[model samples]
Target chain A: MDGIDKTDRKAINFSEKLERISDLWQPRVIAEMNDYQFKLVRIEGDFVWHDHPETDETFIVLEGVLRIDFRDGAVQIGPGEMFVVPKGVEHKPFAENEVRLLLIEPRGVLNTGHAGGNRTAQNDRWV
Target chain B: MDGIDKTDRKAINFSEKLERISDLWQPRVIAEMNDYQFKLVRIEGDFVWHDHPETDETFIVLEGVLRIDFRDGAVQIGPGEMFVVPKGVEHKPFAENEVRLLLIEPRGVLNTGHAGGNRTAQNDRWV
Candidate 1:
């Protein structure tokens, strides 16, 4: 009883966990590895331009298309693809359609990063 | 040119990277975030029983099925599913068919972990 429970040992399914999220842009924690957290988020439209000065952020597309626009260029990520945004680099994410994403970064990382505002979601919200 | 190059900023496609791997059990690094790395691997049959004493390992299944057997039980991961094998927890991975996986772990961690053997692949082999 002190060790991992049977439920905790089960695999984390993206589609199953995603069904619990009803809001857009708000990320829900699905799993963790060391100090990092794997978050599932549904996003559409455009996101604020920001940068994590302390750590890099990873974006893995599970469904739809996601385009991250940088100062100089942009990268489009579809399902089955991923992109890593380096620390201190400013970028904005845009999706014309609803996109399901798996974001990986250190715990306590803000969705808005340094560009804090109303767009900043409550951190550590697990589904 | 001191910053990220155009080619480096492109999205990393899992399927495209996986096509280059012709061997089983050998993982090829596709991208890196901070000190961590994202690797794509094709695995079948069984793997060595091992444990990483220093860090946890993440397995995201892209195709086929993957079963990680723990001391108490086992967890099966399929496409769009993931499991984090905690550090120092001995486990063995078994696949009935070819399983394409995306592995996330700190740089320098081997496929066999502390259980060094013929299954130990050359570290840092990038696709």
Candidate 2:
């Protein structure tokens, strides 16, 4: 369904959305373009190692730092930067402090990918 | 074709990429996740009324303000904000000053969409 109505279709402020939630690692679906979903999540500490076999996941850091540990190495992402985990490559994202970032992925794709755990958030939860 | 090597897959700074180009309306591909591409563009003045019939377009404002005029109404998107123009709907994006933003769309979609003009930029150009 096209949700471009007057109420929520206005300029979605990032800080405003981030302030609305205190839970970490739970992605809040903010907007959708085509079949892809734009999600915002505040995550800290370690995450489950997983891989999405069908789609790549994009991460755009808005605040703090994020360290994505790959199978062989790790990449540290800073604020105002981004990184993408390719399809089928297992990765675990970690952050020392609270980090806010935006995730872009196809609709219905699980956050933990093939690794189902307590950290696996419900898909399509909006803030 | 996975470009997640140690070189370009690192964190991409938006301000650095926006500084690399002075041309308006041209989108520079910074990173790719699956079939979608993350592009940075700077735009000012007015753009042609266009619509991507095959896919929707996403615009994330990094600096300045963006006004998107739709068929029925218009939207003003500011820095740290975003707006998604639905598919098959006509829209014209304008800004009084240069606006820096990120655009996520499929790899081959043109900027001008069906309303091709001199403002049509070369796709897949990286900064």
- What does the lDDT come to for candidate 1? 0.94
Which CAPRI category fits model 1? Answer: medium
Model 2 DockQ class: medium
After superposing candidate 1 on the true structure, give the runs of residues whose Cα lies further than 4 Å from its correct spot: A1-3
Residue runs of model 2 more than 4 Å from their true location after superposition: A1-4, B1-4
Cα TM-score of candidate 1: 0.97
Q: What is the interface RMSD of each candidate, in Å?
A: 2.9, 3.1
lDDT of each: 0.94, 0.88
Candidate 1 iRMSD, 1 decimal: 2.9
